[model samples]
Target: MQIEIKSLLKSCGVTSIMVTHDQEEALSMADRIVVLNKGRIEQIDTPDALYDAPASLFVNGFIGHANFLKGRTSPQPGTIALDAGCALALAGTAPPPAHRDVMVSIRPENLALVSDAQPRSIAVTIRVVMPLGAFSVIDCVTASGEAIKVSQSRAAWSGRPGDAAWLMIQDISKVHVFEATTASPSIARA
Candidate 1:
């Protein structure tokens, strides 16, 4: 379907502006991604940047699966103490709002299964496991009931449901922190 649209655009010599609710469709069709929320433009950037470095929490959750972690800000500098026993170091130097509720967005693919040799291993219990063609997704919950989804290799887990797994976030640097949005002003991102 995407190839057909691209071919049509090329043949007609027309620049098309396609609006789609599906994020994959938008990523495949548009050269520049425009993310709109509630009839307002939230972000306009390249596809890679839009996905990797989302402007806000709505953009991050819309582009990919985001695990919202509750955390607090550190007094010293660019550091956050996250729930589920993790301390996140922020890339930006500015201090976050102190004593306020914060959420961190981390992509599923960035979380990797780790062995004992790895440094950053966090324990989680598998609630459910669903196998796609290329990758297997493990639905897990931390000890504190914060749900986490990790996309791992098909061969990573051999057991059925109710198994324990430890994952070491391979790309911690990719995690982003954003101010939480409320229901007063609903925002949609695509």
Candidate 2:
């Protein structure tokens, strides 16, 4: 019905603007999306662009499920030292200013549960697990009380609540960095 309506509108040369709170609906229906935060425009882009390259923390969090870690940029390019003593190094994007406080944003699906602690891995305790048929949503908490969610195939993870695991970023290119301030700026767009 939605597709048929969109097609009919397009055939009639009619332009329409839809205001929806459903992220999936907006992503699927709109040609371009204007993400607003507190009535202020945060980003304006296509659905794919908005999802893949959000312009700010608000946009990133609004578009999809994201895990935010407080950190500061390292002296080395593309590295961020998390407050929890973990460090993240992005592979493809430009690094943020050294020593500048920043927040790292990564989608739940981008994180993987690993048995061994790797170079950029963070230790988290599995708090809850929700099995959703094909996949499971694992809720974890860092030692510092920071909560993170990881989505993976049901067969991939077998950890129960209270089990310790390492959270590893699957791809450095998928990381997003934003300034850790009220007037935050996006350092890594995509």
Candidate 3:
């Protein structure tokens, strides 16, 4: 119905503005999106641009399911030292300035459960599991008490709550960094 309405609006050459709470609907139907929080404009951009390059932590957390880790920029380029006592190298782009506090954001779908310890792997305790047909949502908590969520295909994962596992990022390019204090506009990428 929404798709049909959108198509009709487009075919009639009429500019339409829709206010919707459904993220998927907004993403699918709109040519441009303006995300508002507490009556203030958070960010405005095309759907893909908004999802791939959210300007603030609120926008990042609001637009999609994201796992956030508190960390500080490492002395090494393209790296951050997580408060969990591990380091993660920012992939595909230059790292934030050294010694700066940052919040690392990675979408749940981009994370994978690993069996062996590997580079940028973090140990977590599975706290909950939710099955959703083709995929399952796994909730995990790190040693540092930070919560993380993973969305994986049912066939790919077969773990239960209370299980200990290693979580690894499959793609470094999907990592997003924001200033810890203000969730400022994305600076590392653009």
Candidate 4:
């Protein structure tokens, strides 16, 4: 039914406004998106831009599944000391916020599992593994007790709870940092 509606609009070359609460629906059907937070515009951009470079923490969480970790400014510029037990080296897309309290977010699929010896890796203990055929959703915890999630190929989901492992950010560009705000730490789950 959704596809039919979209097709009808497209076939007639009609410009239509769609108001939806379904993020996936909006993402798939719109050429551009305007995200609102509490009735205020948070960001206006193409879907790719909204997902890749969210203007703020709220936009980042609203657009997709994100792993939020508490982080802080390190002594070094552009470096964040994650409470998850590692330092995150950003891609230099933008300067780190001046505030000491910041949050780091990355999609689960963007995280890579590596040997515990890897540098800049976040130490986590495997909590649960949900196999989704081609891939698996892994729930884990940092030594400091922050919950983390990783998406990996099912064949590679071999770690048990006590197994030594670390998470590597595959592309620093995929990492988003924002000044920690009083806003809720997580998106409302359905």
Candidate 5:
């Protein structure tokens, strides 16, 4: 499809600007990504950075489903704890000055489902289970009543709806932290 577009543009002897909401298609075709938010350029960077290091909370969520939780920094190095009334673990080195009103994005693939007893694992109750060809989707709620969705291989899900499970977020390096936003409620990660 991208080749076809490029050829079409070349044939027209005109430079073309393609617009799309699908990040994957844009990333694969465009030389550089121009992210627009409500007619404004929120960011213009390579696809890798756009995905790996988003410019804002809106961009982070727009690029993909990200988990944003309220958190604060600890005096100790290399950790941040949730102010969401539960202990949660993240997969990266602590950011400078201990972030307040924190927002973190955790991609579904990086989430691990485990028994509820695991330390720093967010306790959840299974709400829905969907099986895709290569992955399974599990919708669960944290103990604090926050919803979370995780996509894992079919083998990982051994419990049924109403059963207790834990959604463990690891590999903090892959997660991106954004400045918290209160203009609207943040969507739970899926």
Candidate 6:
């Protein structure tokens, strides 16, 4: 139904306004999207733009499933100390001034299971595994009880509940850092 409607809209060569609460539908059907939160425009961008580089925390959360982890700016520039007992090196991004509370978001697809030999790997205990056809969603928890989700190919991952594993963020650039709302709502590059 959706494919046919989209085809008709395309064939007609006319602009059509589609309003929906479904994020996936909006992303698939429109060239540009405006995200509204509490009746205010939060962001306006292409789906890829909104997903890859969200303008705000609200838009980041609204567009997809993001693991919001607590972190603190390390003394070293471009480094973040996660409350989850690991540090993230965001070499490609701008860091906030040292010693500030921050919130970090990493999409599940950007995380991969890695060996303990990996220097930047994070330790987590697997909690649940949901196989969704070609992909598998694994739920894990850090030492601080921070829940993180990882999506991997079903055939590639063979872990079970209660297993301790290491996770490596596939792309540090995809990691987004935001100011802790306790003081103010702001954006950070990492």
User: What does candidate 5's lDDT look like per residue over 1-190, in tens digits?
Assistant: 7889867777888766778878778877776788877689888988878777887777777776666665666665546676534544445545546545566567787788997666677777989988897789888877666677788888877788999877777675786665566643353211
Worst-scoring 10-residue span by lDDT in model 5: 181-190
lDDT of model 1 at position 139: 84
- What is the TM-score of each predicted model, taking all chains together? 0.84, 0.89, 0.89, 0.91, 0.80, 0.91
Please, what are the lDDT tens digits per residue for candidate 1 over residues 5-85? 888898999997887888888887888988887778989998889998888777887886776666777674667776666
Higher-lDDT candidate of 5 and 6: 6
Alpha-carbon shift of residue 95 in model 5 (angstroms): 2.4
Give one digit per residue, the lDDT tens place, for model 4 in 22-84. Answer: 999989888889998878999999989999988888889899789999989877778888888
What digit string (tens of lDDT, one per residue) describes model 3 on residues 28-136? 9999999987789989999999999888888887785678888999788988988866798777866568999998888999999875677679988899989999999
Q: Scored by CA lDDT, what does every candidate get? A: 0.73, 0.85, 0.85, 0.83, 0.70, 0.85
What is the alpha-carbon lDDT for the whole of candidate 1?
0.73
Pairs with backbone N, CA or C atoms under 3 Å apart (clashes), candidate 3:
none
RMSD of candidates 1 onward, in order: 3.0, 3.6, 4.0, 1.9, 3.6, 3.7
- How far is 150's C-alpha from truth in model 6 (Å)? 0.6
Residue 180 error, candidate 1, Å = 2.9
Predicted structure 2: lDDT: 0.85
Residue 141 in candidate 6, Cα distance off native in Å: 0.7
Q: On a 0 to 1 TM-score scale, where does candidate 3 land against the true structure?
A: 0.89
Per-residue lDDT over 76-188 for candidate 6, one digit per residue giving the tens place of the 0 to 100 score: 99999999878898967786789998889899999987535378788899999999999999999988888899999998779898999988899898999887775322232
